[model samples]
Target: MVSSRIVDYHEDLVEEPEVELPQMVFADGEEPVGVRVLTYQSSRAINTILNALNEAEIQYLRESSFGKLIEIAEKPAFSGRFARYLLSRQLKVEKKHEAWFRFAGNPIRFSLREFAIVTGLPCGEIPKKQKMKKKNINEKPYWPELFGSMEEMRVSQAVKMLRKKTVTDPDIRMKLACLAIVSSVLLSTNLKMKMLKEYAELLGDIEEFLSFPWGRIAFDMLMTSIKKRDEISLSQDTIALKGFALALQLVIVEAVPALTEVVQDACSSSESESDDDEIESPVSKARRKTLNPAHAREVDRKSEVNIIFN
Candidate 1:
């Protein structure tokens, strides 16, 4: 289990003996915005509401799936510019498990191993799609309550519903927040995101949901998207990166601390958020009559994140 602070697994691998790498390769461009998860308020709620519950003698934060993640969010906003620059330098590779970036003339590999350390997320293998695609899913506690008649709900819409103050149960709220973070933040990309039914069903047991290897799924989503686009597509004026670009940014930082002063962070830069991710009033009827009602864009199969790993 990861403590409050993320360990430098990258540093452990590099060791205190190796000669330091050169300055990082730099690039200039308009950074594409990843999904704007409602972390600002959601994190607060976790501390104020979720942690205060009488669930156990131990603090809920210690036991939560996203305990370290919430702590990471509080540190600083995602560095979209830096992340984009790193992606631009990605080298072509045959393997899908890891991405190699040419940083300071040295190749730094960002794989599930590095991702787990930087993000403090479990990188366990996910169950096969065939097993997860069981029938009669609507009966699950989360399916009908969160979905009802809505066939396809966007990740943003699900975040909105979960962020509502009306959902008073702390345990329930914690589970929903996990879904929001996974669908909205970790796997965020240019294309509109839909809440996976399989993900929602897992919330039926918070323990099972926590036990799942979301980090592996997130890594696969990001690497697949990167693999999908080559240098040409990344250089195009219409570049939209898939997966959580920030993960790459953090990994880059860990790999080379010298570049920290060079790249511009999204928070300090006050980078304007993408219109699609701007936080909307959960109470807005135009968006959805209720969480039980309308939501998000249809999942584009072409760009849909393939996290159903064997």
Candidate 2:
């Protein structure tokens, strides 16, 4: 039988000393250039060489042994604009690639110069300066007396003053009247009715007031208040509703012509049954009887006011 032996590799584990590479030195007779070159095993170094080569050379390298080196190297993904910038710079191999590598991923923010560097595009130009016109310093403030001391005056006195202002300064009168109407509406139930009645009496001929834009504004306010009747507290809703109804009635009485035109337009548009196609159902007969001209005339004569109470 042949003798068999096994080798032990554990004995070969020895510590090696670190070796330092030699630095270039100038000879005594030769002048030192004072310049040094450094290299990195980084993607930027490979990119620098790749960027310089012709298309054929690049293709040949990519298919040869150098292809493995390119694959193993840490080449950064560059944006189209940033790649153009790198091409524009024409940087050398072994350069400090870290500065350019920092912009590899999406940048959080960038200065205009850095943006231009990466994008290879110019920054937006600054806008031209403009001259401003001076405003008039001596212009007097308008209607200073309208708000001042008016609250201290009695209701009668205020009304008289507003009436006087109405002819010469209608805007101020409208403002004051609108303010009074809003204040009266917001007061407690009893006070609200009292104040509104007083205002109605003070205005005297409601028709004359409704002729102005301010009267239309007051009319709108009254109608809006009526529509919001359900939103009022149950305790005050009755009195408030009555007041709004009365106010609206008074306005409508004054603006009857405009209201009549609207009513006629509405009635004309409603479907009417012709005698030829008329159906004689009990309900239809009753409705026709109620709407008959003779019966309507009798009712109109009895209630000269021509207004629906509701």
Candidate 3:
């Protein structure tokens, strides 16, 4: 009976072992922190310790000041895990990633790449380097090659070339001269009186001269001659001539709207010309080529022309 009882007691002890509850240790003065009890098994006591450690870590993160938080983040003991958690919480709650970035001396020490690695978040792509375009030698005019021999050219030849380049079609020139005269009369009191006196001397009746279109044309032609004289005065390179050019430019500004209107009217009037009858001069063709493709097409369709007559 004693032998049977011993065997039965040994079997019962092997079947069930007594479990001891984990005790959390604290300092002599400090109170013990709370922990979640999962299983009664001693093997699961490690999980309780882990839970206490996690709580301690979270408490450190929460109670600490900004400087202390940075100190804790720099510690290798946490392996950046606490730093990432703190930053993630900050991003979620405050929607401010720049604070941490600013603290880290962003772009230099703590770049987007570092931020991405710490947070396990997607990073922004680096900007691609822009390739500089090579300038077209054929497109640009060589100023030296074109104007280098101008000093050696004859005065008459130079004058002829200048006139050819500066002056437009005869009709356009006349229109611009008319516009300039009208602008001068409106803008200058002295010019207006001079024009009135010239008209009175030539026609004997200034009102009749102004009423007639042909008289207006004659008056504009006379004013144009006066402007040409002023332009000739500019050849001396005097300070007064410079002031005169400035004054003339100011006067011309007043005429721009009228000039634009006259040109548009001329374009409208010439719109009915037959394609076969229209002669495309070299200057006009070059001008057309310089225009934007859409504008060029519009010009071709509308028979509209743009000329620099001034």
**Candidate whose TM-score is highest:** 1
Quickly count the clashes in candidate 2. 0
Model 2 Cα lDDT, one tens digit per residue, 104-209: 1111111222222222222233222101133246733222344453323322233334433332454445434433332222221322112232233213332332
Candidate 2 segments exceeding 4 Å error:
1-143, 146-154, 159-212, 231-237, 241-247, 251-310
Global lDDT of each candidate: 0.51, 0.25, 0.22
The Cα RMSD of model 2 versus the native structure comes to: 44.3
lDDT of 2: 0.25
When summed lDDT is taken over every stretch of 10 residues in candidate 1, the lowest stretch is: 288-297
Residue pairs whose backbone atoms clash in candidate 2: none
Select the stronger candidate by lDDT from 2 and 3.
Answer: 2
Query: Per-residue CA lDDT of candidate 1, range 1-310, in tens?
Result: 2332222223433575465433222232333333222111221222222222334412454555556665554433453434444566555556667676654445567777777877677787677742665657555546776667887776556555555544666666666566656665666554455566667878777777877788887888777866786545565533455556556656655554444333332332232233443334423212101010001111111223221111
Top lDDT prediction, candidate number:
1
**TM per prediction:** 0.64, 0.21, 0.14
lDDT of 3 by residue, 87-152 (tens): 221111121222111111111112222222222222333222211134355644222222343323
Q: Candidate 1 lDDT (Cα, whole model)? A: 0.51
